[model samples]
Target: MKRQPKGTRIRLLLAAFAAATPVAYGFFWSEVRGRGTPDGSSIEVRVPEGATSLEVAGVLAAEGFIFRPRVFDAYVRLKGQGRQLKAGRYEIPRGASYSYLLKVLQTGSVVTTPLTIPEGLRVPQVAERLAAYVGDSTATVLAWLTDPKRIGELGVPGPTIEGYLFPETYRFAEGVGIPVIVRAMVGRYKAFWGTEERARAAALGLDEREIVTLASIVEKEVRWGEERPVVAGVYWNRLERDMLLQADPTVQYALGEPRARLLYRGIDSVADHPYNTYTQPGLPPGPIASPGAASLHAALHPADHDYIFFVARNDGSHEFSRTLREHNNARNRIRLARESAER
Candidate 1:
């Protein structure tokens, strides 16, 4: 048999190669872009920790989300994202393309629950909100909060992590731990107290914790912004004169529940409680609630006044008084107005 000429053989080889290239390319595209399940349902895939890109591809393939794991692996490596796939449970569409799967895994787009903690929530209330965030029992969460070692690590002084968790809308990833959430909240609270706020607290002869404690009282006392500083002033004045703070909120705090109308019997019941301001003759042992930014600012910059008493106007406002007689008169006037209106 005679061998073919070199030129003729080369031409035949090129023709054959050219014919197969398009077919191979077509097959590659079809497989990479193809959907996974027949119904286009969403598929749940868990990528184990420290798993390589190829390993992730294999995992997805086992979950019936990918037809060709090598192609997925090649796609990941070609994009220079071999080590970028994060470890987490992912809810990917069954028909997700190579590009979509890579994007989701690389970005670590885990599902999150947005938790909005309102101001004035005590520690227990904060635990309740956290329970919803992480599906932990409230008791478990409270334990985490009150853990002495954890509280020490968090730089909080109290027996529990109270009055330090900042109120905000936080987007917590699913399966996130309680310690992470607590750190996040306390970190926000720390960030809020800048140099100027700290300096003001020093000028007032109060430490950072003391300011927060007073701010918490102001937060529970009045909801209106204008009244916050005024109410703080009355308390500050009382402190200066060594008079009882006599904050109704303190009585409510001692009772462990809010009362629509606090009676004398209720006050007497908790008279021995350390949180009762009427009997304590000063600020309570600590903050009664988590104060918001407004209350914190007001506590730092209380209105310079000699007002020693305040009567709630029942309209989110207060009538400040300079003396006991003035405060008593104001209270009587409010009572008379209420009585007359009742008739």
Candidate 2:
């Protein structure tokens, strides 16, 4: 082929450069445009505890909050972000670029407010904790719980949002919406109920809602993890025989009080309440607390025994019995143990 003239070659080079410029700019600008402008819009990003960099990238991509999560991975690789990524809430620019978002998450830049919902706490108590932490009124939290719109938004498969909110430590950003937190907690509950648990519940002829209700009862009965299955078995036996659960937790739930001790009057009051297992047969209307995985598992696969009663032992364990006579003896044993310890 004949060599081109110098000027023509130079012109050709310029044309090639011009052609490539738009493609390069388009790629770069697409990333930029997808990202939220840092001018005024801020977003809260959560880097889950013990999450991998790829998991974080997936979350960011799914949220549409970051542009190019691959860029997040690359940034983490270069900046050692993977090692430094902290589990907490982070405030970031809405539509932040993946690199910037990763950096923010890596540095724990999300403002964190601690919310602790203790085990066995009722919905009201959990609402109060969230209210105190979020600086929102407890009424606002309560309203959110009862708001059918909000509950629907969370996709909680029930009429009310009660018993769906998982109890655990949650770190929320300053501007994180309450609905978002509630949905996240509910999602946690669903996730915690793995396929195995679902299958077990199905085998037991129980649905998710019923399992949760039973789990809540088991949770109340089980002060110690070891005793959970035992208590669960007792409840299951009672349920099979058409006996009242006669659970004090249900009575306490009906009374809306912390059940350190049970009152005979309360159980015998006969005032109609859905949660009073003494008055009502079968599971309560809903869960009383967010049952952990253990409780849920126990609810589905109760211990193989004919136990119909259990009494709390002094060391947070329980004594199980098959019959009322056996249960009475166990109860007396526990009472004697308590008295001896008191002395």
Candidate 3:
């Protein structure tokens, strides 16, 4: 038997270690960090544009989608794929290993689902849209929005979450929770209301929530930004004069059901509901809809006008009048215009 030199044996062992390192990494990555699952099931993980490597790792780890972020980092750094990880959205498997996650990101397998939440939707309507977007039940969203405890948990200083949910288009991955979506919208609303609006609302003897309530009525009443101030003025005038606002939106809210059209008889008959401005003689108990910035500003600083009645013209504008006679005339003209347009 020939004895190998000590130096030669050491060199051979070093070479073997070098060769085994990558294989060990691959196997460990599969077992602990998620390399490959036999089922090939995929999941979606968003790495948002402009996220740092650390941020990407933290998000994945926090979401429990990845078991070993360091392994992912190391592999990406070695492969020079760290810089190749594009932002936007990605679909990853539930038990995806770190290596698989890195590969998915490097290959730009991000998925983005467009979420369009229209303007002027109430909580229930918005919830319905959200559920449809995530393929969840609308009731799930309502359960969160309507939960007073949930509102408190969000740190919103309000009794309800009605006026705080800002309406806008969102890009959400599939299977997001209702609370997460609501929190995102509420956070946007908080940012919007954080500036001069809060102070202004306080000075006007209105709380932030009350201002939102009034803004909501203005939102439903006025279609044009320029008209919002005037519409707000009319409601303020009614509040000052001790006259019933008799806003259609308030009556609609009182009805507790959504309808495309409202009848005079319905307004006259809907009784004892707090949101009926015609009966309550002031702003409704809460917001009628989630108002935008323009409506909110208009509510805070209404135009100086005594005009009490506004009828929607055939065009997307309103006919403002100071007296019942004038209001009736405008209404008649609107009716005539509608008749003409139908013909």
Candidate 4:
């Protein structure tokens, strides 16, 4: 066989090397693509809205969530997740594989903070709790809640979204805006106010706003689940008889702050405020606190009783009475029991 020219042989070797380059690259990529960086710490990565895959990869790499931005971008594209990456604040774990991190971003598994708004919390209280969770101040959340336009947009028929901020446990994405938080709570209230609940309110000759107001009062009055409807019935009876509600919660609310215990002087003094149900002939202008679903239901469907009064038994329950004499007797009995216990 004739020997090839040295230059031709050299060209052949170069061609062979070029042809094997992609295979070598494939082996190297496989080895590193699935391997996680040796950092066992967590880092937060924020992908802004409308960010491209390349931009997201850069953010992750810069944040130390990944070792190679270009490799991440290529992997995302290969997995058809280039357009699926969601915009949010994500807590990327250290040593997470590219695939795992990509999945987290694509699925929008953003970090969330849990916030629980308990029953009978006023808007201000709720705002304070929300501020602690979302890094917004109570004033900021209150401003968002009290904005008439925002309240109107939420379909809450009031000057403020007081009763419309449904009390429930919520998980919010980190760095969520105030409007988004308010809207979420109000939206939950709207959703809970189903057609049946609305119909019940109409049947009771009360609008949605009135029902919510009464429910809030009932929520503040009773802590026992079974006592809600009975307490609601007492209030309904008082309203029907044109009698004073004399709800202590209303007095506390009118004081513009929470009190560990309501004094008789405070109750008497708050009678001048419009929210003073003891002096005001009708329901207050709006809900004093956020009522849960149970309280709302109780307001719409009060127990069928002639109870016009109720006094707490100091046991997370109340004693109902149909007549003033009976109510006074119950109060005296409660006082005596307390005195006896102290002795």
Candidate 5:
């Protein structure tokens, strides 16, 4: 080939450079804008409070959600969203583009698992439900519940936070620590337990813990709204008369396992157990389960009545009586009705 003039060669090189520059820029832009990974499944990413953009990028990269932390950091800065990154657990969809992820982080679109802690669930039951959503195991949650330091920190008055873990619907981030979850639950209890309730408890010659203990019993005993205060009144009547509570649920609690139906023999056998009200002179040492707001209120404000006994009517309701003879007659009637139905 014939050698070209120096100026012409220089001009040709410049043209080539200009052509290649656009291609390079396009490739870079596409790389930055494209999905970070090939996997199309969802992923969870946790950004701790006060985490810098670089740290967040590193976490994403480590979790296989992103291919390049350095590129992610640069892109975040370029978008002026570095300071907007929020701390939470996010469910990043599979094949999500970098821009989409950035927006999710900036907008605090975290993945929250809804947890419904129903009224009257024991600590173990609560822990099992919690373990299904959070990172902790059931055993870990149980330990946290009984941990003296944790309970003390939360200012719960009992040996464990059994009755104080307010039962309600809560939204928790995936992989949330046990302490944070416990604190949130206890906080909810404190919020619902207002000053007026405390004053009412004091006026009734009971402390907060005693009130919760009685409320837990009421929650387990009755399911109907109108029956709570009536049942609470019956228990109060027994207490005032220095009579044994003789509650069947207390026997079940003492056995550490709930029975579908407690026979007379079973109740007799467990009567001596500390939690059994049939033999115990007073209330159980602590609450058997978490009480709902209505049950708590009922314990604080029991209805004034002369009734001292009740029995389930097998239809989500109860029959009450003011005397032992009437209670026995009602029990006989229920037994006859049950026998007739079975026949």
Candidate 6:
């Protein structure tokens, strides 16, 4: 072989260097900021609360997000984003890169399920509503709800946290615990009572618990906000007069089974029960169900009216009366109207 000139050797070395530089630069850029082509298939993964970057990287590795977790961990920490990892259920694509995964975790764009708890549902019903998200059996969720220690921990004054869980549409993280869900609901309840609400409660000569109890009955009796205050006033008048509330909803609560209508025999059946307000002279031992904000406000601010009785007409509205004779006439009219409609 002939010996080459030193200048020619130097030129060849520089050319090789120039070629390798772009390749290395491209690889570095891809590792730092590029995303992989997403495949259609994805797996669900959960990053636990307070999870470190290395632990999250390990989870991704085991779930097949990446082949090398240490490299990914190093990538996360070196970028000063270790503490930015959020905890929640996530949908990870099979072909995603470390950069993409970090982006998902950093942005905290986790999967959330919207849960709407309607007003007037019992605690057991609320527990059933939470069954799909809590990964527990309905019985287990109920047990969690009725747990004495948990109720005391939550500062609930009621026997079972019945009325404290505010009914609303809540976006809960997928795979969240039952305690977390209940806490969120109770938190909403706490936020609902500002100074104005508390003052109204005091002026009405009622505590939050008593107001919730009455509000629950009002919630069950009426379908519209316009009727809430009037219904509440009927009960308030009965309470003031030392009269039996005779609220059919309270008897229904005692019966525990949903009936299309509460007949006289049904009321007589639970006459001994405290929740049977047709027999009991005052509010029941506790709330029968969760009350909405309007119902709560109505309980605090009942309508000032002399009406002492109300009967549900065939329509959604009710016919209220101030005297027994008037109430009887209204009842007969409602009965005749119903019979006519049936005919």
Highest-TM-score candidate = 4
Error of 6 at 258 (Å): 2.3
Candidate 1 lDDT, 149-239, residue by residue in tens:
8767998756456788889888877678988988898998988889999899999998887788899999998867788898888888888
* Candidate 5: tens digits of C-alpha lDDT, residues 94-174: 767788889899999898878899999998999998777675688977886777786679998686788999999988766
Cα shift from native, residue 67, model 3 (Å): 23
Worst lDDT 10-window in candidate 2: 28-37
lDDT for each residue of candidate 6 in 231-275, tens digit (9 for 90 to 100)? 999999989999998888888889987799999999998889999
- Model 2 TM: 0.67
The C-alpha stretches of model 6 lying farther than 4 A from their native spots are 1-23, 36-74, 82-87, 91-103
lDDT scores for all predictions?
Answer: 0.84, 0.75, 0.76, 0.83, 0.85, 0.85
**Model 5: what TM-score?**
0.75
Report, for all candidates in order, the number of backbone clashes.
0, 5, 12, 0, 0, 0
Question: Which candidate do you rate higher for TM-score, 2 or 4?
Answer: 4
Candidate 5 Cα outliers beyond 4 Å, as residue runs: 1-84, 87-104
Candidate 2 lDDT over residue span 1-343, tens digit each: 9998756764575467558897754564466445555577666667788888877877777767756777556546545457677777666666676556666776677686767766666678778978877789999888778777865677765546766788778777766777778777888887877888777778899888888888888887787787788788888888889998998888887887775778788777645887888888888878887777788778887888877877778887777777889989888888998899899
**What CA RMSD would you report for each candidate?**
7.6, 11.5, 10.0, 8.0, 9.6, 8.7
lDDT of candidate model 5 versus the reference: 0.85
**Decreasing lDDT order of the candidates:** 6, 5, 1, 4, 3, 2
Compute each candidate's TM-score over C-alphas: 0.81, 0.67, 0.70, 0.82, 0.75, 0.81
TM-score of candidate 1 versus the correct structure, residues matched by position: 0.81
Task: Report residue 325 deviation for candidate 5 (angstroms).
Answer: 1.0
Q: Candidate 4 on 1-343: residue-level lDDT in tens?
A: 9998756764565467558896756654564454455666777878899998999988877876666677778667656678999999888777777778878988899989788889888878888998788777889878877767876587787857788888889898867877787788888988987888877888899988899999999988888899899888888988898998989889988998879878888888876898998789889888988999999989998988998988888676888888989999999999899789889
Q: Is candidate 2 or candidate 3 better by lDDT?
A: 3
